[model samples]
Target: MIIHGNRFTLRPDADAAQIEEALESLRNQGRVIPSVKSFVVGRDFGGEYEWGATFMIEDLQGYWEYLVHPAHRNTDQVGLPLVDKFASFDITDDPDPEMGAKIAALHQRRYDSDATLTQLVSDLGEYKGSAAPGAHGER
Candidate 1:
């Protein structure tokens, strides 16, 4: 499965009601893609960022499906006009499915490691949306 961390900035001035409307809309939209195995949107209570949601996608294609879905396009309708963008980190495991827990633990460690400072610096050097740092010919 691929895990994508989506960050959105609701219209800077949007009130709590507007934010709820956007989140509720996503919840009510039902399944937009078959591969969207599971996803839940919620306010980012964490003080670090504005808002974010973790999506569990069955595959890259499934992630694309939801990206182009009409429901996603309507983000502005519910008052979330500013999409800070998304940070998608692929998670892969070995052959043994029974090792899921161990794999998750490893992945969590990777996520928590502060070594990402190097990546953060590199990304800042030439960041563009969420693609590669120096991917030319890309929008």
Candidate 2:
């Protein structure tokens, strides 16, 4: 298994809507990429970086596929401009006989049975569009 992690700070003028749009794009990318087993993104409070993302790929080939994917390329074009600074790393875990089963169980627990990446993107877009001022507290 390959784990890719990233931490980044968005530009001063970037707002939650822009952030969500980037996240939605990522989710959409994952949907089309078969190598992407699972992915997650989060916001860090009172931290040096504002956001982070983690991606789990099935193997090295999958990792390569993900890198060359058009959706992934779009992220570089559309998402990078909003970032102030960023750092990323990849970890290749040692092969374990039970890793596949563990990954399957973990994915099942983390994602809803009916949930699809498209739905997740849509939900994020909805939040971006309707979110009210101060709804998330100052900043």
Instruction: Give per-model TM-scores.
Output: 0.53, 0.62
Encode model 1's per-residue lDDT on 1-139: one tens digit a residue: 7655545444456577766777766664445655567776776775544566666766545655655566754643453343333332335433555443433343333324434422432433122233222222122
User: How accurate locally, in lDDT, is each candidate?
Assistant: 0.48, 0.59
Q: Which candidate number has the best lDDT?
A: 2
- The residue-by-residue lDDT of candidate 2 on 1-139, one tens digit each, is 7786666777778777887888787777767878889888778567667787778887756766776677876775567667766655556675666543443333333233324432332332111111111222111
Most accurate candidate by TM-score: 2
Model 1: which residue pairs collide? Answer: none
Clash-forming residue pairs, model 2: none
| Model 2 TM-score, all chains together | 0.62
- Candidate 1 lDDT score at position 86: 32
For model 1, what is the C-alpha lDDT against the true structure?
Answer: 0.48
Superposed by TM-score, candidate 2 places the C-alpha of residue 129 at a distance from the truth, in angstroms, of 33
